[model samples]
Target: MSIQLRPTRPADIPFVYETEHAAENRPFLLPWTEERHRQALAHPDIRHLIVEETETGRAVGYVIIAGLTNPHGSIELMRITISAKGKGYGRQVLRQVKRWAFEEQQAHRLWLDVKEANQRALNLYLSEGFVIEGKLRECLKTGERYESLLILSMLSSEYRD
Candidate 1:
């Protein structure tokens, strides 16, 4: 199945919200409000994109690049969600977004913090060239317990190849 990543349109706001609100995704993303999304569309440094299935024309996920700044170039994945986890959309979207960040944004580095238990996502990031730079113990509370956070990063020079 073909897939594409395009600049998110205003009409995509609701679908983005729904996809992020799905059961399997809720815990992985920060909670957002309608006003937040509206503001996001206007945010200068944030690049938000929507993922669409080409054959069925369905909205499946979104990728958000936030915390952009010059010189000290850095980016954090504000959000990423896929309707289904193991269907390969996550990797496709991640690679595309990383390429855009490396080429268009000229980012010096891209970084993300994943819950220690999110092995699936950690594996994807590692396979895509992000290295485990550090770990923070009990950094975030997932439920009744605390979860360690793993900091993963990939440099622009590394991605250039």
Candidate 2:
């Protein structure tokens, strides 16, 4: 299914909250509070977007990107959670983000960090040309144990489209 990303509306916060904290997605991500999501909408350097199906116009996921106007020309893919899986929506949205960051925003680098256990997301980033930069070993402390996050990035010259 094809997807289009649009600037998120205030009404979409609940959907974003629900999707991020849902059992299927919660463990892999650090859940943000509703107010935090609300704050992101007004943050000058952040882009909080909703992913909607082009055919149905329903919100299936959301993406949080930061450093829109960084002096270093580097942007971070803060978070991306697609509730509707198994339809290639994640790849489509990621490609769109890459185009927007490199072509439109003129970003020199686009980067993100993914939990080591999230092999699915890691594979997608690697396939899309993001090189693994480093790993923040045992960085995030969960309830009992720590979790590591692998940092990955792609430069403007490396983007295919």
Candidate 3:
């Protein structure tokens, strides 16, 4: 069960887009267009990576990290999408992202906002040592309704490794 993250290539965009719009993943994330992904890929501040199963060389998921080019020590875990669930892929991806942020990137803080109703994601973030900083009420509008988001963060000092 070896997993690795690699730079996302242009050919991987469609798979990433499909995973982003998958029924199981859509509810937890904001709507996005293919152009947005392309922009991220081109942006100096963003890193778009594809998560692969090392044994099979299959892409299991993808992640988008932002604010890396900023002088500030804070970075955002902009997006992470796992095509398959219930197999610990999210946990593994998150652990790798944290290590990259705190260790490799020398970031002092890593943060993200999750929809409050996304219990599974909230649980994963909490279990990974991300602390809830606060809640933003009615922050997003999906269709005709508004939703709240919970802000979670992990500081470099709080990182285990």
Model 3 per-residue lDDT tens digits across residues 117-158: 999999999999999999999989999999999999999999
Candidate of highest lDDT: 2
- How well does candidate 3 match the true structure, expressed as C-alpha RMSD? 1.1
Q: Show the colliding residue pairs in model 1.
A: none
State the C-alpha lDDT per candidate. Answer: 0.82, 0.95, 0.92
C-alpha-based local distance difference test score of model 3: 0.92
> Could you give candidate 2's per-residue lDDT for residues 1-161 as a string of tens digits?
79999999899999999999999899999999999999999999999999999999999999999999799999999998999987899999999999999999999999999999999999999999999999999999999999999999999989954
- Choose the strongest candidate by TM-score: 2
How much does each candidate deviate from the true structure in C-alpha RMSD?
1.8, 0.9, 1.1
TM-score of each: 0.89, 0.98, 0.96
User: Model 1 — which ten-residue stretch has the worst lDDT?
Assistant: 69-78
In model 3, which residue pairs have backbone atoms overlapping below 3 Å? none
At residue 104, candidate 1 shows an lDDT of 85
lDDT of 1 by residue, 1-161 (tens): 66788888888888888887888887766668867887888798887888888788788888887877545888787667788667899998888878877898888889988888878888899999999999999877767988788898999989977
